[model samples]
Target: MDERIEISMLLDFYGSMLTDKQRDIMYLYYNEDFSLAEISEHTNTSRQAIFDIVKRCNKILIEYEDKLKLLEKFMKLTKTKELILNKLNEIDSSCDNIKISNSINEIINEINNI
Candidate 1:
């Protein structure tokens, strides 16, 4: 996975563990695409302080992911769901009965919602 995307995912999974200031800074840097200088200006802090906070928050997020593996499990579950949906689609295409096709379609919708 891309580092930015992985960090974004980590932010989603473990952001609550961070201090409010840390979370807000990460959100601005990663999600809002703020530069360190921009964040420093917005927060009225030194750019070096913003940089240090971002660096520390990144370490914290990575540490949480390393220990918890929520992102890994989430990726596995997503892949499994996609595979199930693909198989269901194949089965649906092969079916001739209208009722069975409708039932399979309903199942596909439910799986998509997952």
Candidate 2:
């Protein structure tokens, strides 16, 4: 998996466990792609403080994921969602061919009903 995606899942899985301040700093740095200096300026903190906070947040998030496997579960869920989306796209593309056949439409309607 991509490192960014892994980190993103880790952040999502473990963010709620962090203090609001930590969460805010992490989101600013990771999710919003803010530089440490930028975050410091925005939050009215020193760069070193932002750096320490982000590092601490990373450690906490990592520990949480390691203990709980929440990130793993989230990653699996993401993969499943992508698979379903791809399958749906394939079905959509095939619909053009299947449109001429009533049976396929019936099957599609049945699947949709389910």
Candidate 3:
């Protein structure tokens, strides 16, 4: 996974835990693609303040992830489903392997329900 994608997913997963000010700053910086100066001007704060707030919010979000692991669990579930589906496709291409492919598909469905 790319770092940008990981960070983006992390922000999405834990965004609700942030204070309003922290959420606003993070949304502006990451989702809105705003510069620090722009965030500071919009929020009427110093650029350094905006930087510090964003850093602190990131630390808090990461700490929550470290302890709770919701994002990690979600990522693992997604990756497992993808791998299973890919294997099923490979087996489907082998005409002699229909039964195995069907079983794999069933297992994939069950994992998705989890």
Candidate 4:
């Protein structure tokens, strides 16, 4: 995955573990797409300070992901769900029974909501 996107995913999964300041800085830099200088100005800190906070926060997020693997598990489950949905779709399309196909569609939708 792209580095920014990967960090964003990690942040989504593990950001609550970070301090409020760390999470705010990360959200500004990554999600809001703010530059270091912009973040510095907004936060009333030095640009280098903002950079260091972002860097340290990134490390913390990566460490949490490494230790907990929540993001990894979530990705695997999501991929598996997609595969199962695909297979179910194939079955539904090929089957002659409309009721069974509808049931399969419901199953697929339920899985997707998870």
Candidate 5:
């Protein structure tokens, strides 16, 4: 994955655990695509302070992912979802019986529940 995309995912997974200010800085830097100096100006802090906070937030997000692994599980589930959908499509196309059609719909509903 791209570094920016990975950080965005990490932030999504663990951002609630961060301080309000930490989240804000990270949001601006990553989500809003703001430069460090721009973040400093927006937050009224020194650029060095903003830089340190961004660095710390990155460490914290990575630590949370290392221990919690929410992102990993999410990626796995996403891949599994695709596989399930493909298999369901195959099964649906191969079986035209009404019962099999209903079963496929049920299976699709269950996948959506997941």
Candidate 6:
């Protein structure tokens, strides 16, 4: 995965563990695409301080992912769900089972929402 994307996913998985300031800084820097100077100005801190906080938050998010593997499992399950849906599509087309296909699609949608 791309570095930015990976960090974004890590933030999603582990952001709640961070302090409010840490989470807000990360959300601005990563999710909102704010520059360090921008975050510093917005938060009334030095640019260097913003930079340090962002760096620490990034490390903490990675550490959480490394230990818990929640994001890893989530990615694997999402991929598996996609594959299952593809196979189900193939089978449904061949077998002409509308009711079964609709039921499977509903289940897949529920899983995706999770």
Per-model lDDT: 0.94, 0.77, 0.83, 0.93, 0.94, 0.88
Candidate 1 C-alpha lDDT tens digits along 6-83: 999999999999999999999999999999999999999899999999999999999998899999999999999999
Q: Write the per-residue lDDT of candidate 2 for residues 15-106, one digit (tens) a residue.
A: 78888988888888888889999999999999999999988777777788789997678657667766665666667667666554555455
Candidate 5: C-alpha RMSD after superposition: 1.6
Q: Report the lDDT tens digits of candidate 5 across residue range 1-114.
A: 998899999999999999999999999999999999999889999999999999999999999999999999999999999999999989999897989889998999899889
Give the Cα RMSD of candidate 6.
Answer: 1.7
Clashes of each: 0, 0, 0, 0, 0, 0
Which of 2 and 6 is ahead in lDDT?
Answer: 6
TM-scores of the candidates are 0.93, 0.66, 0.71, 0.94, 0.88, 0.88
Better of 2 and 3 by TM-score: 3
Q: TM-score of predicted model 5? A: 0.88
**lDDT (tens digit, per residue) of candidate 4 on 5-104:** 9999999999889999999999999999999999999999999999999999999989998999998999999999989989998999899998998899
Clash pairs detected, candidate 2: none
Off by over 4 Å in 3: 1-5, 91-114
The residue-by-residue lDDT of candidate 3 on 11-88, one tens digit each, is 898988888888989888888889999999999999999999988987888898899898999978889878877776
**Residue 56 CA displacement from its true place in model 2, Å:** 0.8
Lowest lDDT sum, 10 consecutive residues, model 1, at 57-66
Ranking by lDDT: 5, 1, 4, 6, 3, 2
Question: lDDT at 78 for candidate 1?
Answer: 98
Kindly give the stretch of ten consecutive residues in candidate 4 with the minimal lDDT sum: 14-23
Better of 3 and 6 by lDDT: 6
Q: Cα lDDT for residue 106, model 1?
A: 97
